[model samples]
Target: MLFDFDGPICHLFPGDTAKRVAEAQVRWLEERGLRDLLADGVREEPDPYKVLRAVDLRSPGSDLVAELEEHLTQQELGLVATAMPTAYVDPLIRTWSAVGARLAVTTNNSPRAVGRYLASRGLTECFAPHVYGRTPDLHLLKPHPHCVRRALDAMGAAPDETLMIGDAPSDHVAARAAGVRFLGYARNARKAERLRAAGATHLVGSLEPLLKVVYAVGDIKAR
Candidate 1:
């Protein structure tokens, strides 16, 4: 199984993002009298992407990334984490692993970022050391089947026998391209309709509800 890590496992940006770290950047800049940073007539309000855009003063790319990195380093950002194992996650994975369901993560994020978060959340022990990412396989992002195919190859599993469980359209598209089953993680009902339209085989919001499906009569790998 290939799982997308962000939304299902953690809330990186937090809530609607109105009062998140993105908002704090402007405040941080202002405190330092860097009000000139907002001289571009950029957003002073919280509009999700607007606050983020303002941080870069509307310019894009590595420039934006560098600025954000610098800002985060100076500020004490908040991170809400589970005190224990992510309740819905730990058992399901160990169960699946026992049942011989090979697991992998194929995300657009760099391996460093993934590793940092996983280690912080104490989730590093969940999988084998070979947690694959774009670092070694930048050629394939989630929208492409290259990474997914590679994961299956690593496990010696064929496409038809594999499954991709994720929260976005790229998950479905990649599964389709790789001929694997796509399980949509519609954790939010608001996005459920959209994922359905994208051709997801099953619409499940929580990882807790997936074990039955994994070992079920349907969709099992054929010998």
Candidate 2:
């Protein structure tokens, strides 16, 4: 099983932290006279990763992009303390691991941040080195399937046998590209609508149902 870090696992930024981070990134660029690098639409983006991607698109392979990516990573690392784990996800992850299911976290967030958060939750062993996250290569971020493919290769798992749970349309697109089954986790109506519009047919509003399924499977195996 492959999980997306920011949503299915935890809400990494909480309330307005992500928006503030994006604003800070813009300010950082403006201070360097690089504000023009961002398009009008991207300048106001609340997701720092999207802001980083916009800068990367304009100046790919530049020191400026690298620095900005690192800045975003630092902000993410700082937010880990206040990140909220999705309801039931801790138990869900634990139960899945206990049932002999191999788990990995594939995310656009920094691997360092993912590792720290998982370690804090005592979930490091559930995924460990199988965590594939953002690299210096901004283009590899999902909806690209790069991280998902990395997890599959490391685990020697087939795409057909793997399942990916993510909240975004990009996750859906990436899973389809990689030939993996996709399960959408939409915590709200707005999120559900967005996933539906992205052509995602299978979605859960919460992880509780999945937890129940895991319990049933475990019971069946034990019997």
Candidate 3:
């Protein structure tokens, strides 16, 4: 199973707390006289990943882009203390692992941040050495299949046998590009609508349904 870290595993930012970081990145660019990188309303956009994407598109392969990405990664690492774990995520991870599933986190968030959270939650063993996340290259982040493809390659898992559960259209797109089954984990109606519009056929509002699936499979295995 390939789980997207931010939403499916936890609320990376509660109360849209990432806005400050996004604003900070914008401010950093502005201070460095890179104001031309700003798209309209970018300062007000809350998701730092989008900000990074904007900067990356305008300044790919530049040292400044690397600096900005590192800055954002630091911001993400700093925010891990307040990140809320998604309901049932810990047990779901443990249960799947117990049932012989090889899980990997495929996220746009920094792998270090994901590792920090998992280590804190004692989930490190559940997905050791398979956490594929942001690299220094911002363009590789999802909406591109780089991370997902990396995870699949690392696991030596076939696309037909893999499943990708994530909360965004980018996840859907990445999964499709990798030829993996896509499961949309929409926490609300707005997200559900977006996934639907993106052509996601498998949608779940919560992990509760997946828990049942996991337990059922485990039960059969035990039998």
Candidate 4:
């Protein structure tokens, strides 16, 4: 199982905290006289990932892009302290592990941030050595399938044999590009619509149903 960290695991930013992070990235760019890199209204954009994407578009593979990614990673690490835990995720992860499932986390969030959050919650060992996430190269972020490809390669699992659970269109796109089956986790109507419009046929509002399926399957491949 390949899970996206931000939503299926936990609400990475409990509130509008990501707005602050996005604003910080914007300010950093402005301070460095890279204002031309930002899209209109980027300062008020609530999604930090969008900010990262904007910077990357203007400066792909550049040191400036690398610096922006690091800044975003730092912001993510800071949010880890107050990140809200997803309901039932603890038991879900444990049950899947007990069933002999090889689990991995594929996220746009930095690997360090994922590691920090999992460690803080005592869930580190469940996914150790298989957390594939953002790297210095911003071009490799989700919708590009870089992290998913890395996770599949590391696990020695074929795309057809694996499943990805995520909450965003980018996640669905990435999973599709990687040839991995995707299960959408839509916490709200807006997310549900977006995922559905993106060609997601399997979706749920919560992870509880997934837990039930895993329990019934008992390590047997159902995909």
Candidate 5:
């Protein structure tokens, strides 16, 4: 099983932290007279990854893009201390692991941040060497599936047999492109609507139902 870091596992920037990070990115550009690099939509976008993507779109493989990505990575690492774990995810991961599932994290967030957060939760063993995350290449970020593909390759898991649980439309697109089944995790109505619009047919509003299924599977294995 593959999980997206920011949503399916935890809320890395719970409240306005993500917004603030986006704003800071904009400000960082403005300070360097690079505000014109952002489009009107991206300038005010609250999602930090979008801001980074916009910069990379305008200047692919440029030092400026690399610097912006690094900055975002630093911001994410700082947030690990305050990231809120999704309810029922801890047991869900452990139960899945105990039941012989090969777990991995495929996310746009930095792998360092993912590792730190998982370690903090004492869940590192559930997904260790298979954690795939962002690189300096912003274009490879999901909806691109670079990280997902990496996870699949590293684990030697076939696409059809792998299931990816993510919270965004980009994740859906990426999973589809990689030929992996997708399970959308939408925590609210807005997110569910977005996933629906993105063509996600199977979705859950909470992880509890998934946990229940895993427990049942474990029970079956025990018997």
Candidate 6:
């Protein structure tokens, strides 16, 4: 069995929310002339994720996040990507399925969000009835392992036969708690190191390296 989402199948889901938050922060900085205090030659298109994550930290007790969320609904936040599909995901799933691996998704995001993007990408039928999202599974969010456990149950997969790949620390941690091995899909190395610290058994900077895992090791070979 295989499990991976977020950076592998898609990029961060709240991309538009981050963009709005970054614009808001920039405006907030300019309003207070804080931009003037920065060193020279700092021009660059601001990364909305970094900008918003910083804001999220600066105002731990602030209602700003809720305010931001109110302005950016679930659908408003685009599931933007930093990379195109490394290879046709359908072939990978099909190959793995023939090798006896069942594929499924367990994401903290609302089920509708996944449906929305997959529908947009024309990749919905690939997963079949194996997606578990927060839409109706609110009680089983990530970092808790309930969703993954449910997936295992549905697949009739044992922990040893299951391999989880994800791009975040929570993804690996959740896999550990659910008793499975994990590979850190380090889409961004700096961020993925933190997940490594949390016990990601292996790291793949990009999906192109899957040939090594799926073919060479004969480990988790395509179904």
List the candidates ranked by lDDT, beginning with the highest: 2, 5, 3, 4, 1, 6
Model 4, span 6-89: residue lDDT tens? 999988876777887888888898999988888788767888888988888888889888888888888888888988888888
Off by over 4 Å in 4: 218-223
Q: How much RMSD separates candidate 4 from the native structure? A: 2.6
Model 1 ranges with Cα > 4 A deviation = 17-87, 120-122, 136-139, 212-223
Q: What lDDT tens digits, residue by residue, belong to model 3 across residues 1-223?
A: 9999999999887775778788898889889889789788876789888988888888887898889888988888887888889998889999999999999999999999999999989999999999999998777889899998999999999999999999999999999999999999999999999999999999999899899889999999999
lDDT, candidate 6, at 120 = 61
Q: Per-candidate TM vs. native?
A: 0.63, 0.98, 0.96, 0.93, 0.97, 0.64
- Give the least accurate 10-residue stretch of model 1, judged by summed lDDT: 75-84
* Model 2 steric clash pairs: none
C-alpha RMSD (angstroms) for model 6? 7.1
Best by TM-score: 2
| Candidate 4 similarity to native, TM-score | 0.93
Show model 3 residue runs off by greater than 4 Å: none
- Winner on TM-score between 2 and 3 is 2
For model 3, what is the C-alpha lDDT against the true structure?
0.91
- Winner on lDDT between 2 and 4 is 2
Residue 190's C-alpha lDDT in candidate 1?
A: 71
Give the clashing pairs for model 1. Answer: none
| Candidate 5, 1-223: lDDT as tens digits | 9999999999998878889999999999999999999988899899999999999989999999989988998999999998889999999999999999999999999999999999999999989888999988788999998998999999999999999999999999999999999999999999999999999999999999999999999999999
